[model samples]
Target: MRALLRHALTEQGFAVEQADDGVSALEWLEGNDVDVVITDINMPRLDGFGLIERLRAGGRHRDRPILVLTTESSDEKKARARSAGATGWIVKPFDAEKLSAAVRRVAH
Candidate 1:
């Protein structure tokens, strides 16, 4: 999944950084600043929802756009992610063009 996402974004000229899970993502974020964030709902250690919450709670990335990409498409989950500060959602297997477009839109 990660490799696929990397290909999709990179093909469109976007540089991407990946993390195994939310914990690693957060750790990477502590020292790096990105235009946007792409995350999955389900992962080991802190989940996407928790990651979004933590980012929202912080001063540095409070306004950062976060896009959720996962297989889950339930409205309940969408609402939960929205409430947690997700900027948008995309269900996998995602279309490369749309994913890139979404990233472009949110990144600015």
Candidate 2:
């Protein structure tokens, strides 16, 4: 999934970085700043919800746009993510154009 997203975004002229899990993503964010973030709901070390919460709690990335790309499609989860400060959501098996458009919209 990461590979696909990176490829698609790269093709659209956006530089992309990927992490294996939420822990790695947070570690990368500690030293790097990005215009947007795309994460999955389920991962090891820390789930996406926890990641979003941690990012929201921090001063630096509180307003950073995080786009959730997951298979889960529960309204409850969506509400939780919204409460945690996610900028947008996209279900898996996504369209490349839609993903790119969402990224562009949120990044702006």
Candidate 3:
């Protein structure tokens, strides 16, 4: 999924960075800046909701866009993520064009 997103986003002229999981994502963000964040709900070390909460708690990432992309579609989970500060949600399997468009919309 990371490779696919990287290819698609890079093809659309967006610089793409990836992490193995929430832990890695947080580590990467500690030293870099990005316009958008797309995370899956089932990641290891820290799930999407946890990741979103941590990001929201940080001043540097609080106002950034975060889009949840995952197969989990339960309303309970959706509400949980929203409360955790996710800007949007996308269910898999995703379309490259639509995902790219979403990234474009929130990148600014």
Candidate 4:
């Protein structure tokens, strides 16, 4: 899924970086300047909710848009994500077009 999203982003003329888990994502943020973040809820080593919390607490990405891409579609989960500071949500099984659109919406 990550590879596919990376490819799509690159194809659209955006430079892309890959992180396998939330831990590495946070670590990467320490040394990188990212325009936006798109994460899944069920990731290993921290999960998307925890990542959002950490990012918000760090103060660097507090106002940066975060787009949550996950299979969890319950309203409760969506509310929780929004409370955790997610700017948008895209359910899984999405196509390349949808991915690009979501990225453009949040990253811009």
Candidate 5:
């Protein structure tokens, strides 16, 4: 999923940076300014929900677009993500085109 998202974003002219876990993601965000962030729900160190909460608490990334991509398809999970300030949600096994479209819509 990460590879697909990276490929899709790169193909659309985005220079992508990757992190294996939420801790690294937050660390990267400290020094970098990203147009958008796409993350999975379940990850080590800190989960996607925690990442969003932290981002929202921060200054620069609070209002930045955040898209949650995960295999979790439950309505409850989606609602939770929305409440956490996620811009959008994409279920796993997603089509690259669809994911790109969602990213473009939210990033703008």
Candidate 6:
């Protein structure tokens, strides 16, 4: 999934970064400046919700846009993500065009 997303986003002319888990993702962010972030809900170590919450609590990436891309599609999960400060949500098996558009919209 990560590889697919990376390929799709890269084809859209965006430089993509990937991490296998939320812990590693957070670690990468510590030394990088990114325009936006797209994450899944069920990552190992921390999970997307926890990552968003942690980023929100931190000073650096608080306003950074985070989009959740996962197979999990439920009203409850969406609301939870919103409350945790996710900028947007996209279900898995995503459309490349829509994904690119969402990234473009939030990256600003």
lDDT (CA) per prediction = 0.93, 0.92, 0.93, 0.87, 0.90, 0.93
lDDT of 1 by residue, 1-108 (tens): 789889878989998999999999999998999999999999999999999999999868889999999999999999999999999989888999999988889887
Give the per-residue lDDT digits (tens) of candidate 2, residues 50-94.
Answer: 999999998678889999999999999999998888989898898
Evaluated at residue 70, the lDDT of candidate 4 is: 94
Task: Give me candidate 6's TM-score against the actual structure.
Answer: 0.97
| Shift of residue 96 alpha carbon in model 5, Å | 1.1
Q: Per-candidate TM vs. native?
A: 0.97, 0.96, 0.96, 0.92, 0.94, 0.97
The C-alpha local distance difference test score for the whole of candidate 5 amounts to 0.90
- TM-score between candidate 2 and the true structure: 0.96
Error of 6 at 46 (Å): 0.5
The predicted structure with the larger lDDT, 3 or 5, is 3
Per-residue lDDT value at 54 in model 4: 89
Question: In each prediction, how many residue pairs overlap at the backbone (N, C-alpha, C within less than 3 A)?
Answer: 0, 0, 0, 0, 0, 0
Which lDDT tens digits does candidate 4 get at residues 1-108? 788888888898788888898999999988888888888999999999999988988667777888898999999999999999888998988788778877887787
For residues 6-103, write the lDDT of model 6, one tens digit per residue.
89989999999889889999999989989998989998899999999999998679899999999999999999999999999999899999999999
Q: Write the per-residue lDDT of candidate 5 for residues 24-107, one digit (tens) a residue.
A: 999999998988999999999999999999999977798999999999999999999999999898888878788778877888
Q: Which pairs clash inside model 1?
A: none
The residue pairs found clashing in candidate 6 are: none
Whole-model lDDT, model 3 = 0.93
Question: Residue 44 CA error for candidate 3 (Å)?
Answer: 0.8
